[model samples]
Target chain A: MTQPAISPALPADWRDFFALTKPRVMSLVIFTGLCGLLAAPGSLHPVLAFTAILCIAVGAGGAAALNQWWEADLDAGMKRTAQRPLPAGRMDRESARDFGFGLSGAAVAIMGLAIGWLPAAILALSIFYYSWIYTVWLKPRTPQNIVIGGGAGAFPPLIGWVAVTGDITLMPVLLFLIIFMWTPPHFWALALFVKTDYAKVGIPMMPVVAGEKSTRRQILAYTVLLVPLSVVPWFIGGTGMIYGVSALVLGGVFIVLSTEVGLRSSVPDDAMKPEKRLFAFSILYLFILFAMLVADRFATIYGWQA
Target chain B: MIDDPRTHDLELFRARQKSRNRVLGSILGALAVLFFAISIVKISNQSHKKAEAAAAMAGQH
Candidate 1:
């Protein structure tokens, strides 16, 4: 077999493969998936739940690896991602590609065999959506890339719900919608701060393609949508008054920050205070919303009415 | 297809490392699954015994 000559310039090892998995992102995905599994009404075998979480982690890792592999050239140009495994020449591109495919295939197969078909199917879709559809196609083509592509991240809770109940319900779909609406504000804030890096790399992120004013306007729009969507689960009776109050309070704060970001005009070249504030608060918003979901789940489980 | 000796040697090194890592990963994965299974069985058994004792006491009463 005639293998291509290994690039002597880039000597990579196993650690590079691990780094390509984007462990930080995988942590959030796994946490939300676990929360969904735990919150669902149906019972799942403990071992099965563990397997489901593991599969979600593996699938997320695989997708992240493939994203790194596909975006290696662009990543090399971006200061934020210049140190990634592929761009840093710590791993051969082909190796990363193979590892991603292997991990993704194993994760989907294990999910289907051990858990259920619906969750496995959703997992498979998420992997492909991120790896190919989002990374390969949408990323380079449009500024609304993150908007459509956010579905990949939003699937975890739904996958978790399906893992437990073997069906998709309105509640999980609402959970999906909440994240979907939240993604634009969260990511666009980061994009606004890193617009120059994206512009230099020729990646058409919202801030780069649409300009900061338009991006901020879009962020406000999404935040407005998100605030209402956040309270939907409570209104629908999937969650309790506690989550309702949390959603309203958190969503109110999110709107204030987003409005500030929209109204601000004199931000310094190197200083992105509004963007930074939005990004920091966005993490808190998602965490509190999901935490409320889990709290409500426990309340119901313990027979606490309200 | 210029066969550089250094490149060939590097390829050989990578192939060896890949195989070693695969073997190690598989062993660790299998061991983890076995350990979890054993612990689950033990816990379930203990719970079952407790339930059985409670039922017996109830019958006596």
Candidate 2:
């Protein structure tokens, strides 16, 4: 007797479902949100604080899922994103959609009930912004997509601050702006090398639409704008010298890298060394900058050395 | 029977389903604990606020 045929595709497992959440990107969201919560003046009950961060993380995950669901085709076209669960055919679209909506709804509901409706509302808006505004609309249509999409990522810190303070303030708004301005240089650096994959998918990334020269110039411009903005909280007396000095030092290295990237002429078959360095350093820069914000706050509380 | 393709497929499917169920159960359990803790915190905070207000009123009177 002939052996029976076995299905080549395995059923989607929990790990595949988890990958739909884009946990790597979600980590950045959680870190910035946590820093915002920690840096804010007032204290929330530990439970409420945990809930607020949970909501932010889950909501970001939900948005990421919806993005994959919507962009599965586009993702499949790109070498970089082709391995994602939906793109790789590890998961079905309906499961992804249901999971996204379910996670988003639960996160908002828990946030509203446990924390305030205000932060919950912001969380909901952020999910919508990332899923619909960025992923569905701007990304396909415009070269400046990530610039506006920055707002979606920027909401975490603002939401984190508002969760504790229960209102918007200059400080929180500055925190939002810091992330907003930071997004482009960080993303465009990555885009500089990955432009080919974006071009394959017709996504109109900055580098694809504007070319490497313009993209590198814009990266340097955004980095220059970001350094001053990161230092603004200290200038306004919102943070102490710890953050201000760190901003200057970190921003100094950031400028050096950006300048190197911006000034260099691309060689044919080049490795994109400067752009890659800037890209990696940009992530580390933001993580350290936000950590300093929290550290400065604690120093104020405990009278530690700045 | 052990080498049968259909039986191997069935085993893998069952394993995937089992893993998904376990994850779902863990999430539900964590959520239950989270909600309960939120309720307790909110109740205590509300009562403390009420007591503070009542004491202030008494002092004014």
Candidate 3:
């Protein structure tokens, strides 16, 4: 149990407020959401398209701010999170809460009025799901927090598709599932190395509660599911050869990397080469997969491939 | 509130936050006005085009 610190003089700067948004995470969310919008069959007015992407980004940032606010005390215990505005005592808790709610409310309202209500509703749900469901309800209680909480992150692409097409479809649902299944392996890899941080904070991450063997097995299992799920869009003729080939190669590499992580045992922190490699490659895998999806759409539109 | 010695820092922080909120509120207010104007222009443009097309059809008839 980490007690809150008291420091009176250090006021939070603008950068601290920006950091509350988790800009790095927001980047991936924005990219995937943009890809989903591009890959959809129909088109939207340029202004409306921009509005949708902005809403997704702002909503993501708001959720991140709320997550940090809720975890400020727990974060004070972890080395990686102690420097955050709230934990560092540079900003008040009420400030973060009010800022987060303000951004989230504005984003949802703009999305609903400018684009469509469906996407706006999903965006609102994503923020609530991350801030309340994952952070408050699940993280402290269960080792399966990442699994259930994965739905929160997966909403971006689904919302993007709805923004473009005005409804849900098999394609958007598949995109949602792809991210959903991908989250466990992605986060578990990070949890493997940061197991101590989670344990110290009393957060029931898989590695802390279930032991390393179970965590590794679960990681590999998710990777196995994700590999097939990733290839389904291509198999269903939703994407062309370029996307199909990229998914196959990326999925194969993901499996190989995950296998290495699972098979290795008791590697030292300084020598955690395989786990580090898997974690790095997983991010690249998603980026390239989504990029290729958009590239494949352009290829079709340009008559570059049949 | 700032006169309370025990809570001076807290009151100062609250005042800063309120000022920031006021700035943000003004920006949002401006943006809402802009969006409303754009919507009105778009709607009028669409109506104008519809009237022109209707006139063209009636002339042919």
Clashes of each: 1, 0, 0
lDDT of 3 by residue, B1-61 (tens): 5575546666666666676677668878977875876586558757988999999999999
Per-residue lDDT of model 3, residues A24-51, tens digit only: 9999999999999999988876667777
Give the per-residue Cα lDDT of candidate 2 at A75.
91
lDDT of 2 by residue, A121-201 (tens): 989999999999999999899999999999999999999999999988899999999999999999998988878888887
**Candidates sorted by lDDT, descending order?**
2, 3, 1
Clashing pairs in 3: none
- What is the fraction of true interface contacts found in candidate 3? 0.00
Check candidate 1 and list the clashing pairs: A12-A90
Against the unseen true structure, what C-alpha lDDT does each candidate score?
0.86, 0.92, 0.88
- lDDT (C-alpha) at residue A109 in model 2: 94
Highest-scoring model, lDDT: 2
Alpha-carbon runs more than 4 Å astray in model 3 = A1-12, A268-270, B1-61
Q: What is the TM-score of each candidate against the true structure?
A: 0.85, 0.95, 0.86
What is the DockQ of the complex in model 2? 0.60
Share of true Cα-Cα contacts across chains kept by each model:
0.03, 0.76, 0.00
lDDT value, residue A24 of candidate 3: 94
